[model samples]
Target: MEIISKLSILIVILFISCHSGRGNVDVQQSADSIAVCHIGAIPSRFTALHKDTLSYEKGEDNVRMVFIRGGKFKMGSTDFVDAQPVHAVEVNSFYMDEHEVTNAQFEAFVKATDYVTVAERPLDPKEFPGVDPAMLVPGSAVFTNPSKVDGMDNFLQWWQYVPGANWRYPEGPNSSIRGKEDHPVTQLAYEDAEAYAKWAGKRLPTEAEWEYAAKAGNHTSETYYWGSEKKENGKWLANIFQGDFPMKNTKEDGFETTSPVKSFPANAYGLYDMEGNVWEWCSDFYRPDYYMQSPKSNPKGPSSSHDPQEPGLVKRVQRGGSFLCNDEYCERYKAGSRGKGEVNSPTNNVGFRCVKDI
Candidate 1:
């Protein structure tokens, strides 16, 4: 079935019938001479699994939305090697969160709504009884220097899996969100973000809307959300790694960790942290070649597929860049350079905002 670009709101329920499977797979050159799997393989069992149901229930409280006018713009990148073959895309008007969900907001949602984050819970033993206890620890990704590096790259050197580092405890067991309410909440999985959106009468923006908003009407191809220039008047526009990634960060932005959502200037649309801070989650399943087949109007994503590159068969899209991003490696600050992450995966540098139909 060909994926259609319609304005009608639908509840997309991802159905996993079988756990073991492989779709269209291709070997592509990744950074540091590593050939990784580029997962965009359309499955043969493609069918209308289910439509997206109502996002928000009735009578949700304390939810805010930012009105975004829809328009036509180039969706992909022409500069990045992976973001090749830019294409035109059109979308309808929608409402999105003013900023990435903050710690205060997330705490309020959990306290009032009695929501339990995925990381806080334990894995179902029936699914994988032989799972390692260490791997199943309740936690999310944390940014920490490796104890001993055996020449693996800088990006790998900085990311560590700290136990008890979920949304409540951002920096593992020892750290907490106390006194840091304004900071954008990290260590949230895609499921956690979706739950909050549903509780707040909103939904996560599709990858298309996220990119369009980042563009902010700049028809010219640019590297960052702000502009082609790296800085403005000798000032850093966004929070990124400097003075060598992983090993040494000068904290040039006056932050060793996450900064406030609006610490940097807004894009042309007045949206802050659209390029820096933390990566935002989108509703689309990542496909590097989706631009080639995506509809010119309101494109969602591929009909169905399995990304072999990921640890398992999870489908989702990650947008914007995180604080760990630098020019030396993982130059994903560009609006078009896409990062493919699993739907259930959680990391310290990954957070999400919300969106709704206008």
Candidate 2:
């Protein structure tokens, strides 16, 4: 309901795109027209192919996972202030989803449990003391970029709350996910993600587990999961915005919004969509200075949450970037960069994968 004021300041300005009423159609066309040379599938010779590594599938959902061997690696980054103090962290072997959860998978869970996402529920009057009861309608934040804008200070210019906007109707009541079941499910609040994870007998990854898995045990201060370079021989490795932020997307990666998971190459650990597509939910609470006191082995993130920009709200860690991320404005697609979102606020650019501890 009334999704404004529910987002963190950074999330508010993180990413936006131009909306042309039929925006999704035009963007999808642009993506389809791009002549991208696809990379070959993961090779069997990779290190993750060990016999001890586990892979599993369950139910009609058919979610697949890859075994990530535990090891010590230097986490965080020197480039961003929040990811500073590059510290050492080690995680035990765990099974991680090969791709982000898809709409088909989420639909299966919802059908089995009749689960209602937070965005689908009515807004409690007690949560907003002074707001008019008439304005408190169930809804979620949807991206709606203007054709052009003068400044970025006002986030409401690009994001709006529309009733009937949920994972099924990402853009609003008018949009549908009919042919896009393979695409990553969006408009999920933290509780929605957690609920899905629990039903699937998995849990959201810790900040440490996420970083370690992304690094794929080949950590060397690389800017991206594949390597230090954003582009490999003039090829896009992830689905990030390729043009002006909040104005245009070149669709160089064959996606205008969320791509079908694994549309691009997987990381060294055989994980897909690790760097871009959508910001993924992490189990840990958010704290800018948590790295300073993080434990050497298996750091699970801060015990409590804190964001100076929005002190009253509880925030959780959101890893990777989204299709809206561009180097010109938001360079969050780089490895070790950090993002946070209010636990109850579901935006179009956020989704999540799950992990199971061995």
Count of backbone clashes, every candidate in sequence: 6, 0
The most accurate candidate by TM-score is 2
Displacement of residue 287 (Cα, Å) in model 2 is 0.5
Error of 1 at 157 (Å): 3.7
Candidate 1 stretches greater than 4 Å from native: 1-64, 127-135, 153-156
Distance (Å) between predicted and true CA of 339, model 2?
A: 0.8
lDDT string, candidate 1, 250-347, tens digits: 88877777888788888777788888788888888765556667899998887764444333456677778778767665567666777666555566
lDDT of 2 by residue, 67-165 (tens): 998989989877666676788887899999999999999999878767777777765566546756666666667766579876764555566666778
Looking at model 1, the pairs that clash are: 10-52, 11-51, 11-52, 11-53, 12-52, 24-41
lDDT of each: 0.65, 0.72
